[model samples]
Target chain A: MTAVLRRPTAAAPRARGRRRMLPFSPRHIALIPIAFVFAVPLLQMFLAALSPSAELIQYPPPFIPSHLTLSGFQRLFAQSDILRWLGNTVIVSVVAIVSNLVLCSLAGYGFARLRFHGKNFGFFGILATIMIPTQVLMIPTFVMFASVGLTDTLGAAIVPWLASSFGVFLMRQFFLSLPAELEEAGLIDGCNRLQVFWRIVLPLAKPALATLAIFTLLGAWNDLVWPIIAINNPGAFTLQLGMANFQGVRRTDWALLMAGNVVATLPLVLFFVAAQKQFVATMTFSGLKG
Target chain B: MVTHTAVLRGSPSRARARRLGSAKRTVEGWGFVAPATILILGLSIFPAAWAFLLSLEKWNGFSTPTFLGGGNYAEIVGDQQFWDAFGHTALYVVLFVPASVLAGLVLALLLNGRIRFVGVYRTAIFVPFVVSPATTGILTNYLFDQQFGIVNHVLGVVGLPQQGWLTDRHQAMLVIAIMSLWGSAAFTTVIYLAALQDIPAELLEAAAIDGANRWQAFWKVVWPELAAVTVFVTIWQTVQATQLFDLVYTTTRGGPLNATETIVYYLWDTAFHQFQFGYGSAVAYVLFGGTLIVTLIFVLVSRRRSSEVI
Candidate 1:
């Protein structure tokens, strides 16, 4: 991950481009206002989540509160299933991250390295699934899960996410980038394909695997629609869906809802901060490929 | 939760197993792919076919589906709300797609070269992308709330009137567009940055040495390479924007005279809200067709462009 943050050796080329750069250059003194404009909404969200509920709703709208309090957090804890939702989210994310790392890496290794029959055809078939929107499948999936008696279960919530084609593709691409010599050496040393994958390729592919795991965790943590549709029981509700229940038709508790939002979003922000370097490079790469 | 089977080539425990290697390989392939294939088919493909069939029926979910033979499709064609939803989706694409792509392109260009803290900026911008649209939907509701929203507060500070961003029908879609913009622009920027890196520096330098300006070189050389990325983003944005329901459901529920009501939201309201499953199926198919057409156009254009480059 730190490798992504280190400046490239091609500084001379960048300097040449910089010499003729337009107003959009990174060094442009003019971009400050635009950057500030983009930053305000996020700043406001953070501030509003911290502000006292009454001050937030005041007519003049206190920009900066005199007394900052955790009353909203208290209200959220008292009113909603914040903890249970968090637990559910954690369970879902962990399962998804673990399964994606193991299964996707195995599958990706097979696709990238194996000489199995119908490999190309099978891979393309998987890619075709990307075109199908989830909405078109929602009702049928619900019916199928209900028939299997898996409805409202965490199994149902976590399974579809584990079959992430994007993860498979990312891992496969990384595996392709890896040298074949290590795996070949392992194979010659009487290790089987699965063993070679587990022992050799998997260790070498740590950066890519970590990237996939983080992405899966983030996705599962933030997902709302699938859980909402699959689970009718409140016990199974993930944080996002549970937080959405804040908008009860009769009354609006702005402070508590914002606080819940903060709680739900804060961990991800922390995670991003911790993994910022890897996250950016991986994001940059994933965008290009998919 | 299927366990990994003992390998025919490797497992000593299964050494005496009589299963033919060919048969075993075939079975293993299917087994490995089974969970994904079944889930996708059951949840996605089968439901899509069922939705198509249901579109011909006239049934609320409570009653048995009656074969009305295109009645639902006919009704959808004439329904003003269906068209309104289509119009709103189109309007959303018209406003959002370009803004997001341009924002993405500019940001990518800005962050393309070496900078000391480019990673921090990238992560900060991309943070919103990881946020569930549901959260964005809810957060934006508070942010754009006319009476107490931070948006209105900022506008008031600038001496502008506080607008009812989510309530006013005319303004509701714009709010949705802005939220969509915020979430999607990061992704586009990420994609564009990748594409920019893939461009050969020698070609760029050659153009620069030939006295062509940076803008000209970008237009002539960079945009062509970025074409594939652009097409990918547009098609994705179209599919997502067309099927947008989460944000709409959370923000406005298609209220304020059904102004912000998109096709999927309308379908949800009709199916789950009104229990008109047949009508909902019809609307779903219509959105599907819309997506298919848009996707086809993108594919055709990209194919042509790639061929031209070849």
Candidate 2:
């Protein structure tokens, strides 16, 4: 067993080095087609957004337009509150990211390092709620919000995004995986727990924090269901809510609908492209251990 | 306890100081957890408990709530619409979970090798997952439109007859399932890819030397390593399938004779649209209970299977 394990470690690097020299691999033939199939929808969305309205409504709609036009984009901007919706979405996402980082890290640190009464019970209680589907909670949550006069406001969207059980669990798991020695040393050096967390531990937790921020941002930015239930006020619509309503109202305007889709999706796609490494890392980490 | 005893052995004053420090530590711990604890309690635990209570009462969001004492749940049992929605959700899970997982596994296996442009391939596969389900739904609607869709155009190009996609009740759910798979298979792909990379190359080489073919080697080696992840993916996918709303809401609105009405969609339509909060709450609890039971069953079965293998 030991020899088998040792052989791989020794052989793996050299094999990789040899494989890198090949100009092309047979795998590309299969991969290229799969990648094209996967990429076509996004490509289509962009193309349709720029396609002429006549071409968009044509039978078996033209794959490529005779000439690209900005009319769809012009109409999207002029006809809807797309800009305000984008602004609201950004505000929601920013607030969610900040609050999740602060609250989840604090709670996670407490669970990971502090010895308090009911520590296990509290942690497990929060973790247990992760199994409860959000669908079950929406009605009562809406009722509660309505009773508080928070319905039809951005608060309904922002309030739930303020903190999450998964955020707390993720932070705690990351904290636990870290070495305790540095923290112990900080305590010995006369720093308070908060100071230690702020000055010493947080700097080390940047990667985990980034992962949390990314997930929170994505969730808040793309949220549609709750916003649909809560916010009917056109002024308070997030990008997704606005887009959904846009589609509903303009069922036949393919160009306008595609334009809205592009605007709503481009930011996230760009973010994913820029931070592809962290994006993949976050997904794998969450999927395997969440 | 050990610290207290140790300090007591050292000096009386030190023992008192240690107790004070521990008390301070406890306070600090509570301070750290208080904000998150309150939020979770208020948002999750309280709402869940409140939903259970509301399930037993009738309220239309404007008037006084009247207690029904399990009447709503009893009604749910006999309600054909609820059962129809349940059946639709079940069908969705059946269509979605296996196909997504299998597609993910295939994509992961393909991408895991010593390949060129691995990063590019990964991004292509993953971009759809990053796109919101609502956007995906809109894209699906246009792409699969009965009269003008690119899908029908492709069928025509291929010398096959064009078919109604989202419009046909027989094919609407299947279209939704395919769209969902397109958007979400990348999640499982990323997961399985991570697991695949962790498997040692020597094991496959050893199996090859032992005269095991690729299929035999995969079944005997790779499959076992992936069993736990498969369970996790299945349960997650099932939960997602049960909560299928955004796509349907965006595209079908449970349309063409209510063929695509899922539990959550039906629940939303009942409460928000029809003002049947009490009935909706009952539907919600049934969904919650069903999800919990299914998750538990998956865990238990996987546990027993793994133990038997051990």
- Each predicted complex: what DockQ? 0.36, 0.50
Tens-digit lDDT track of model 1 for A43-101:
66677667788787678777677777788788778878889989988998998888888
Judged by DockQ cut-offs, the docking class of candidate 1 is: acceptable
iRMS values for every prediction: 3.8, 4.6
lDDT of 1 by residue, B194-224 (tens): 6776677777778778987767887877888
Writing each residue's lDDT as its tens digit, candidate 2 over B76-170 gives 99999999999999999999999998988889777775445777888899989789977998999999999889999999989999899999999
Each prediction's Cα lDDT score?
0.74, 0.86
Write one digit per residue (lDDT tens) for candidate 2, span A74-193: 999999999999999999999999999999999999999899777888898898788777888888889888989889989988999998888888899899999999988887787878
Off by over 4 Å in 2: A1-24, B1-19
Cα lDDT, model 1, residue A147: 74
Predicted model with the maximum DockQ = 2
